[model samples]
Target: MEESTADLIRAQLRRLRSAAGLNQEEFGKLVHYSASMVSAVETGTRPYDRPLLARADEVLASGGLLVSLLRIAEREGQPSWFLPWLDAERLARQLRVFQPTLIPALLQTEGYARAVIRCDDLLSDEEVERRVAARLDRQAILAQPDPPQLIAVVDEAVLHRRDERFRALMVHQVEHLIACAERPNVSIHVIPLSVGLHIGLSGPFSLARGADGGWVAIMENQLTASPTDGEADLATLSARWETVRNEALSRQQSVELLKEVVKSWP
Candidate 1:
């Protein structure tokens, strides 16, 4: 489990209880939680499992419905591993994504995602379904009534390197990008290879604004993710995101560039 996310989930639960003016025992009784359970969860001494937390949300009436947490949790599958980062991402009011080697995950078309997922020869069909379902489910965050502001910066090379089938998929993907770019909550920028290596070379990262006004940074390698919630680390990621954003082409420019790429598709 990511320590950062674990702490954030616990903090949010504690805040909910405190706001309701309930002590641990009282809150426990309301949600059928044991006092020890409440204490353990709050202290991050126990796993902050989603199902348990969802029941508590019902008792507390947080309206985020706790089920949202569960959904986000299920997406990761390995709760003990990615829960913290997922929790922080779920609670964020804004998300900034920077992808240097691939299309932004949230914006991937079904076809594109299918091709990429198929490349994972180790994944059984069932495993691929599970992963793809999770990825698509995460896109729901963008459609919530109070969805986060999403700003994405993608590397241009992802747009140019594709086979015929992938090219067609990318054409659809770029159209989808154009539509998303029209939303007030979404902004997409493309990092042209011409500009060459920027701060994002550090790695793919997302900076999410937590409900508590703190920022959380998520870094992902091939199969694992790490989160940094320390103010200092968040500041560093935030600065890098800003630099990447500045170096990327504007949304209009990106759309134009994408149009030109699609035209050259064979």
Candidate 2:
């Protein structure tokens, strides 16, 4: 089998770190990441993103070599269909998201994301890991110096669903949600079960507003996610977003609800 781009990059990272006589802890400090993150990238359990690569390149004096490999790995790792949405997400100034069944991807913890992706069963282990890494990488935007405002409204059911098998995962996921909600740029709202039914029940979707004031919407289904800049689609999704958001608890209340849900988990 051919060595994947990710595998090659991992090898290069490991080789360079060894040559520098630095352990994972030392290298992680130089790059402003945790030692575990360095290990994960070196072990190929987590995918490397542009930010990590750029940091490593500068710190290791690799002359952009590490950053150069990120493009190739991203092209190979990410599905072509999702590229447009990724671009939009990076460029957007504000994002409005609605998820009826599960926690939105942007706010999901690694364990929860893995559990969610593993549900397909048909995906090979390699593919599942690749996807989980990609999803986590996308989340870096939120940690940027000037992250876009993210308003996420989820159905209360998303928090209430429980299973003995995923009990720990759910607890961690909810805890992560509370942490995210505390960020000034990130707001999480939940539509209580008391609301019964709402327009958002149709599916999960997101609207991204760019600096130029134009809006793009992405709708997700089982097979793929579709991005649209059509006026009609934007108008419809915008209205649905407003409706669901109005039905959701305020940010403070949502945080309280999330805390309550976390306690109820086990």
Candidate 3:
């Protein structure tokens, strides 16, 4: 049978325990783990957290090997759906984004990012830090020698929401957007409230022109997201992009609107 990851780790643990010349109870005492906990980990019933793995590494004299193995398991731990979208974003020649409720992740400042990312209850603080670091890492591409053009259109009402929890955060985010808009390759636009219902009211999405000349679209639904490169989906998204862009104020006006919102923050 193919060795499952858990099975492989179980074997490693069992071998390491034997090599250390320690019985289950003795080894558990050394690592400050319960005897049953040790048995379960050896049998692959429980997952290893970093602290336990580190302790095992120290006690087994594995020279950080155990911790290194754990790192491999935790690396690239972004949500599965977001990975493909990130791949496309990294190499896109240009990206056009429509945001209905929050700042685009690429342009968000650290404080703003914290406010936005903290909405999730499923994440521990360490996991939240990992995600935030991952997000900031993605922004590095924007500073490369030949960065992609980023065009963003935000709903005017998104900035106007009186969200007390994120009130100050919104002010900082708006200022960041204005500064980013000044970049030679970036364009910012605002979809006026006067436009009344439109295609953008449906949701937010991004259209990317890849460096290889292919096109892709990324759509963000509540908690999940998806990316599509199929011709038909691209066509539909392209048409939607056009409709939304038409409803947005000119780029110059958008910057002014962004600056205008700063006065409303209390």
The prediction achieving the highest lDDT against the true structure is 2
Pairs in clash, predicted candidate 1: 5-84
**Model 1: what TM-score?**
0.73
Model 3 TM-score?
Answer: 0.70
- Candidate 1 lDDT over 89-167, as tens digits, reads 6667888999988788888877778778889899899888877876786687788898889999998887877675566
Error of 2 at 179 (Å): 0.5
lDDT of 2 by residue, 1-266 (tens): 01355567778888888988899999999998789868866874344456677788887778888767656645666654564466668767899999999999999999999999999999999999988988898898899999999999999998876778888888989999999999999999999999998899999999888765667789999888888777898888888988999999999999999999988765
lDDT of residue 66 for candidate 3: 67
Off by over 4 Å in 3: 1-74
Residue 74 lDDT, candidate 1, scale 0-100: 51
The positional error of residue 153 in candidate 1, measured at the CA in angstroms, is 0.5
Report RMSD for candidate 1: 8.1
Residues 1-266, candidate 3: write the lDDT tens digits.
Answer: 11243355557778888998998999999999878868856764344455677788899998887667544544546544554466567667899988878777888888877766777988799888877877787788788899999988888888786778777877888898899888898998888899888888889899877654667788889878878766888898899889988899998999899888998676
Ranking by lDDT: 2, 3, 1
For all candidates in order, the CA lDDT equals 0.76, 0.83, 0.77
